[model samples]
Target chain A: MIDRTMTPLLEVRNLQTHFFTDQGIIRAVNGISYDLHEGETLGIVGESGCGKSISAFSILRLIPNPPGKIVNGEVIFEGTDLLQLSDREMCAVRGNKIAMIFQEPMTSLNPVLTIGHQVMEPMVLHQKIGKKQAIQESIQLLSKVQLSEPEARMNSFPHQLSGGMRQRVMIAMGMSCKPKLIIADEPTTALDVTIQAQLLELMKGLTRDIGTALILITHNLGIVARYADRVLVMYAGRIVEKATAKKLYSSPSHPYTIGLLASVPRLDQDLKKSLSPIEGQPPDLLNLPKGCAFHPRCRYRIPKCFTQSPELEQISDNHEKACWVDVH
Target chain B: MKSFIINRIAYALLILFFVTILVFSLARLLPGDPIQAAAMFNADLSNQEIVSELRARYGLDKPIYIQYVIWLKDFIQGDWGTSLGSGEDVLEMFFRRLPITLELFAGSVFWSLIIGLPLGVISAVKRNSWLDAILTTTSIFGVSIPVFWEGIILIYLFAVIFPILPPSGYVPFAESPIDNILSVILPTFVMGTHGAGLFARYVRSSLLEVLGQDYIRTARAKGLREKSILLVHAAKPAMIPVVTIIGLAWGYVVSGSFLVEYMFAIPGLGRMGVDAVFARDFPVIQATLVMVTVNILLVNLAVDLLYGYLDPRVRVRGNLGQ
Candidate 1:
């Protein structure tokens, strides 16, 4: 459990990541902000194309330029504003203090490189460790991720491993440097249901044991319910709702969040009830609505919801949601 | 692995057999009689009886099928027939000239690799920049210019204007290796420049594609330096397609050696092949075609093997017959 009364491990402030395309200026991560307490998992939930992945990329300053840029943001990690770090300093912080795992384990690893070489890379780069020692440590890390024959598996290529095993390798690599933060962007999306549960369990257990803060980005609400301590529900590149996981699950304040929860077919819910999926498509980032981006599709949208964009306002302690409509 | 090599070799042999038939038929397609061609050189022996004697001596009076059978039989026995023009044994003549062609081939390949790969990397890394534009523009010139014209330009610059090198001719590597290198240098450049341009284009495109792969992003995310990521992680897989281009270029350089050798006055297989074609020397022409086809097959096989080595995924998949 995280001690939220203490200062958060990471604090993102009013981050704005935009893409300057010939067609238009597309707002990808539009003024999103959240706090991640130490040793806690923060779930960033959104439908596809809702800037979930781009926000994670922006935190690391890994967004591609020319088209994509972090126009304005303060990603403060460990008391330093990461966005202000020099290239050299950022490089030092990237893999040593913070690491990330991507969704597609199938393609995340270099095909030509040996698994051991990849796992050992960060140790050598950031830790300044010797190759032999790094390999030894990497083998142990592989085993820690529950991979059998870690020594032999070290020499194997990414293609040789099963999807589940490859995801395990990714976890091992992410944990190699024992970084303080790990941003997993849809890590279990590529795995089947069984493997997904197993991989998530392995990752959660490891992070807990190491006392590392994690930011799990996924579209799966069920995963958030199972793993996250706090949740940030994003819609149209903004944090529409933020609350402790239990509070958010019990009383989701945002209509979008309510729609999200309703979309999932709960096993405990009445057998006769049907899942009600959100009706409209995600808004185009380049051409959002005049006021509230979600107002067009929002089932509880009042006339005010169409004319005015709602800012996140605190309705209760540690709970906030953006909504113009008044709901009992 | 053993079985794979054997399978490739078996397939090559089958192709070689078909190629021999094709070349044998095609070489005879030219509108000239070998007997009459041989007779033209000895105009004094214009009598019908002498002509018939010469025809009989060369087995020119036989049916096409019978002639092919005899040639195949002799070829299998390592007995290439006498050349129509020189009366030299075809095998002996080709063997005598083989070293020159091999030197040119080796030198051109070496030069292309040395010049092509680094330029390609630079072009791809600095894509759309001035450096990339310069390299791309020069490579286009390299590709567009014919090898013989490039050879002529080299001659005019080095031999005529600068007098820095011998414009043409070959030196046997066994005799004075330094002199041989100097003599072959100009022709090698002419031959290699075009190939280098080709290589640069192929390498640039393939490298660009590989650099865009998700693994490359992972490499960057790992905090590995840009240099290490490009060279270590990206270079090998990118080389797969470039390796294929090199293999195909190897075959082309060998067969296309005719103009290059002719322009340089080098006594190589290409020159011999052209002379054989002009003189209607059936045996020599067929033999050279066979050699060229075999070289092509062998080079492609080497490429396939190299591909397996560079990407272990391919090797494992191939081994599993998947």
Candidate 2:
């Protein structure tokens, strides 16, 4: 449940991240803005190439430079403009205030280092704690993540752990400092379906208990349905639709959002009716289609949708959509 | 770990066995007859009867297989045979020079690591910068310049022009450690130059690949300092490939850099090996090749063990096999 009266925990204003390649300049996250309230789970839904992951990366300033750069953005976290902080100051805020869980749990953990060492590192680094205390805390964190034999598991390398187990270790590391926010980028995408459910439940339970805000970035609508309180549907680097979980599922106004919801097979839907998937590919970021980027695949495209791109406008209380023609 | 070491040692022994056969065959295949070469050294042994007697005494008249068996037996028994040129026991001569060669080899490796590793790390971290360009260019020169020419240039600069270090000589470390180091410094540098360049190129490329890995990003996200991310998280895996190169380089150095030893007048195994070749001293040549082959096998074994240590995946596999 979100309280609208208090200041949001994190505010991103017109964030634009681009990649300058030999081919062209890719507008990865083009002028995306959003607010993440305290103790809320916000799901960013998009296809592979859309700006879901990039936007999350931009908020933390983790975009690799030379090719990828945050050209314009104001990421204000806890009354401080993060983009304006010095590198040292920003580092002090990173693991202590906001921790990240990457997608590939297998590759995300260092192969040479022990699981205990990796989990305990953030505590020692940001908390400035002694090794013995960090080790003690890490064992508890491991067990809290429901890993078996937490004591022995600490000395084991990443290669020794299963994917589910490794992701749990990542969660433990993310929750090590008890940060205010955790950005889990496709955290369970690489795991089995059963493991995915268990992990998601674990993450939800943990965040709720600690009151940590979570930004769950995933392409899976089902995951968003089960977890997120508010959802932002992204299409070609812009937020096409934003609404609470219930409203977006009930009355998805944007054609792209409507197409996305229709594509997933619902348990209540007719067994014989095949899903109607969105037609055409996502527009290339390098050379996007003029006007609405989704216009090519959008079913309810008017002539105005062809010449002029639509900005995200409020449709009703707690609901917004970027579309020229209203689907009533 | 114990089983892994034993397996490696067994494999090394097999390679050593083959190397013995190769060295024994190759040494005898040389053009000159050992007895004739021996006669040239001894003016009194000009007649055919005496030459035949000398051949019989040295077992040169026996069938090749029997000769090999005898040589192998004698080598196993630590009787390395007398040097044709110096008439000294080959094993004793080797022992006398082993310390000098070991010092030179050690110093070269030390200098190469000191010069190459940091430069390589810096170059990779500061990629496309002026410092990287300068270091890369210097490495290029190090790799390309001829060793003899570099040795000569160093000699001319330090010994002749400046007259700082002795031009060409060997000082026993026991007599004077300071003079011993001063004398070998130029030789070691000359020997290490190519290795330094090689290591720099290797470490830079290896580290670059490692820095791009997902784990490095995770390390950065954990808010680890850039130094810790590069040195602690990335360096171990990056060094896996670099260690192989170092092992090969060490084998090369240990076998002796003939040109470096000769130019510097350091009485090392390489100098002995080259002198043996000129004199057609079959026993010394055979001994040197066998020693080098063993050294290379031992180094390769150590490299494999070190590789397993650095990468846990490899260690796990090794353990699983046991």
Candidate 3:
């Protein structure tokens, strides 16, 4: 809603994240890149272990060391490469300029701490605010998240709250600092289906009201379709398709994107038609494939698809796909 | 909260009852009769006369059940029997030495916590580093070395080698606080090293497990300082198990370090208990056992209360609706 024509707020350039295990190196996020405009909601849709979460963690430098490392990447946030910033500088950015909410709300909160103390933690740490003022603000934050009886609930421990309420508390914590960007890694993945829709809607409305950009990493295409302004379809640690949410859904170019869309059951579509699940498991990151990683599972594979990899190429205005075939 | 505590207290009482019976049976189970052990020193008295006199004085001629009942009645009414060896009131002897044992226990636990908790935290946070490696090796050595050998080694260093402190004997703190500490310092070191080593290993493992939890990552995500994250976020839950081990070790500490006490000649409960055991002092042995069992029970109860305080989930699990 605000300043859509300005330069991008975040630009991730040729990111390469690898995991060194006993067996061999796993190219988790291999040569992936993207951009996010101010107040843009970018949905990263992929199957499990497709590197969606790792890429987001890479942006924040949250990857566990020794086994995992961002070998090559330039995560430019507001003209500064986040990768180049010192850990102290990054600390100032994390939970201040950029905040992240995790998938499992039940396990993500500290069991020993009261809701008030936890929610007030960031304000006290980053803003240098007194505990009294932080608690008062935390009550307001809890109310903003629609938690009932914010004052009484503030004294309650995480175990006392329901799953949905814990998630709402997590959202309130993420929004407390009014950060420029918020990363939600499958925020509603652990919630009930009905509660899932409610949380997604709540997150969308809050991000909009606060004018904060959101990176929603999820496997649910329906969630992305409903909330994302732009979508990136990832397969085996690579973005094979990128476009506006409507364009990507209506005229999906990549075979993987098409397969993903076909697999989703639609209420508006013909009822008799069975959903077509994509065959074959996601390729192992350690051994991948000789050329194109998706060629082994692609039904439209030609001989060239096995020996040669395809780079993301523009096929239409603001739409890109990494496929040689003209599916359109 | 009230119910849990009340239940714990009830459980402690039950344990105390069992301990009393166990100690009573244990005294009987030992080789040779208490009368025969006492008679060895009085060779002038005939065997028949000594046996009959001791049997009449200790009520040993009665049935075992009646004897236990008599002892329990006397115990409850503050009429603890006299020691066969010294002919003094066993309760009075124990109480006279109780202050020394209590002081040693408090000093050892205080030093252990002061030494162990921080080392444990540092080892966990800097896991795999040289500091962790060195601390781990130190803990292993501390645990493996015999307490007597450690006491002797410490005496050799501070008392013999340096000659700045005395090697043996305890001085009451009331007499001179500095001299009292100087005399017991070697024994205290032996006890503290054993406890600190144990606590360091436990705390390290617990902290490592807690550091890997999702909440720790959340604390980091919230931009909490590393110190705050370690102390407030990671330490509290980790301390639950550490508290348990420390609580259990409280029995060992308070019951008195027998080897350390004997080596240093401290007039503590452990030394008194061992001497009573050798001399077949039934009343003194029974009283010491009961006191040690009570100490263990109280320590366990404190740990449970501390567990509730550290992790509120334990207290709120049943009353979630409230």
Candidate 4:
């Protein structure tokens, strides 16, 4: 039998993804590493354009052509290096083993086809099932995602469905093949809070039932609080901190993480005090600073913090932080 | 649905009425008298006799409105009296020529769609490759080269140079469908090339836009093949714009261009329109313009109906309207 620690479901030693634009080579996903447990939900949190989504896309190799490139990275999943896989081989791994749902449901869903066809497409490709059987499974998936009148919905096109229904359909499709990992990239951002809660709850239950791991990528700390087992905080393409959901919320080590948690409206926060925002915009990925990327924006930046870069090192048995600050 | 049809048909009728009025008035406004043009060929009647006979024959002695009513009444009954120039029944002659123009459009559109869609999808999926480059270049050629120029070139090379395909003529579909096809094929392709290029390029761009959408990424992430990602996910919505282009192209092919028929020397209405304009045959010109206008409006209505079927929001809104 394989050693449990050695055979983690996913492991990335030093992944680095860069983008070659006309302006300059932008390191969208700078070197970072994390391991995913088979059954646990790993929430990847970062503000927009911090390479949170790009990191996930690089794992799937779904980044668009020309400008976006995974210059150096090893997205190790299930004991295989995905970056080494050929286009044909990567395609096989993409839909069956790992799946991703994008942010916008309205544009994400194909306009012309019925949701049924889009859902069954993966089944048709990977399972080698006939059209009729694929369609039946599609109906079942629609209902599984909590859509009512699933059978009638089979004939209806994407525009016929509402935003929430479409997002559910997206979830159902991602779950169709029972993939080992599902990347939900801001799955609920386009939606309001109530719908976001419902979708999160649905995803949690479905993932649990199927024994599938989930990579819930979102900016909202509140979401990861209840849903994720482990949380990886990213800022400017680098992992700033990694901890269990409870520890990350109650005891954030990185200043960025602290700012994020503090910024969230809380019952404990002073009523008279205005809400705190991240001090400044993210560092320009093209022209990165001399030392810590977050130095310009970091509230607790020391001389060492500006001149020296910090690596992610273990603080506790499971918790880790990448900041230079030595917090007890 | 009923309301849509009713509204469209009413609008078509209104447009058709204006076309008729414009054709009738404009034909009369042209300098030469139809009777004088007729007498020019007669060689027997004096100018005075020609004027009186034409006046009596057309009931031009009556008020212009009365003449219009009489003419419109006769036209509705499919008796357009006689050609002001040929003295032959206008309806009978139009009917004889009508099938030719319809066959040209029907044949060309069918070929264009069959060729355009695959070319478009392939170009979209295999973007920036040499194959796409060739298709893009060829489609550009198809779009830029005028139908008449292409027709002349094809005839010179294939018919004149190779002498394999028949030169140019019309065979009734009933007489021999094979000959009918041979007769219209060259002209049809020449006419269709631009539409094929236009449709394929537009459709490719549209499909590319949809393929880059989030759900498509989701489908890809789900491991759906690149082929299905395009065929199932991208092709359907991309076709909306394509449908509009096809409908408009069909109208232009039906009404605007007579060069194809003129080059091939086919006896189609487009050619007849040219002849009527030259000879100043008011009734024939009016009828032809109205027919083409009505056809275009009808096809646009069909496009809207197709949109309803493709998208349910339209259908639901349709129901709500009802």
**Of the candidates shown, which would achieve the greatest TM-score relative to the real structure?**
2
C-alpha RMSD values across all candidates: 1.9, 1.5, 2.1, 2.8
TM-score of 3: 0.97
Candidate 4: C-alpha lDDT: 0.83
lDDT score of residue B65 within candidate 3: 83
Q: lDDT at A243 for candidate 1?
A: 94
lDDT for each residue of candidate 4 in A1-328, tens digit (9 for 90 to 100): 2233656788876788888888999889999899887877999998888899999989988888767888886888998999999888998988789888888999887776778878887888888999999989999999999999999998878888888999999899888888998889999999988999999999999999988889999988889998999999998899999998999987889999988877889777788888888888877888989788888988788999878889998988679999888753
How many angstroms is residue A306 displaced in model 4 relative to the true structure, after the best TM-score fit? 3.8
**Poorest lDDT segment (10 consecutive residues) of candidate 4 chain B:** B313-322
CA shift of B226, model 4, Å: 1.2
Q: Estimate TM-scores for all models.
A: 0.96, 0.98, 0.97, 0.93
Ranking of candidates on DockQ, top first: 2, 3, 1, 4
lDDT string for model 2 (A135-184, tens) is 99999999999999999999999999999999999999999999999999
* Docking model 1 quality class: medium
CA deviation > 4 Å runs, candidate 2: B319-322
lDDT of 3 by residue, A57-121 (tens): 99889888868999997999999999999888888888888999999999999999999988988
Please identify which of the two predictions, 1 or 2, would achieve the higher TM-score against the true structure.
2
lDDT of 1 by residue, A213-245 (tens): 999999999999999999999998999999989
User: Candidate 3 clashing pairs?
Assistant: none
User: How well is each residue in B63-105 modelled by candidate 3, as lDDT tens digits?
Assistant: 8888899998899898789988888998898899888888888
Candidate 1 vs 3: which has more DockQ: 3
Candidate 2 local lDDT, B224-262, one digit each (tens): 889889878998999998999888887886454778888
Looking at model 3, residue B29 earns an lDDT score of 84
Candidate 4: where is the Cα deviation over 4 Å? A1-6, A129-140, B129-134, B319-322
lDDT of 4 by residue, B241-284 (tens): 88888878877864544888888888888988889888878777
C-alpha RMSD (angstroms) for model 1: 1.9
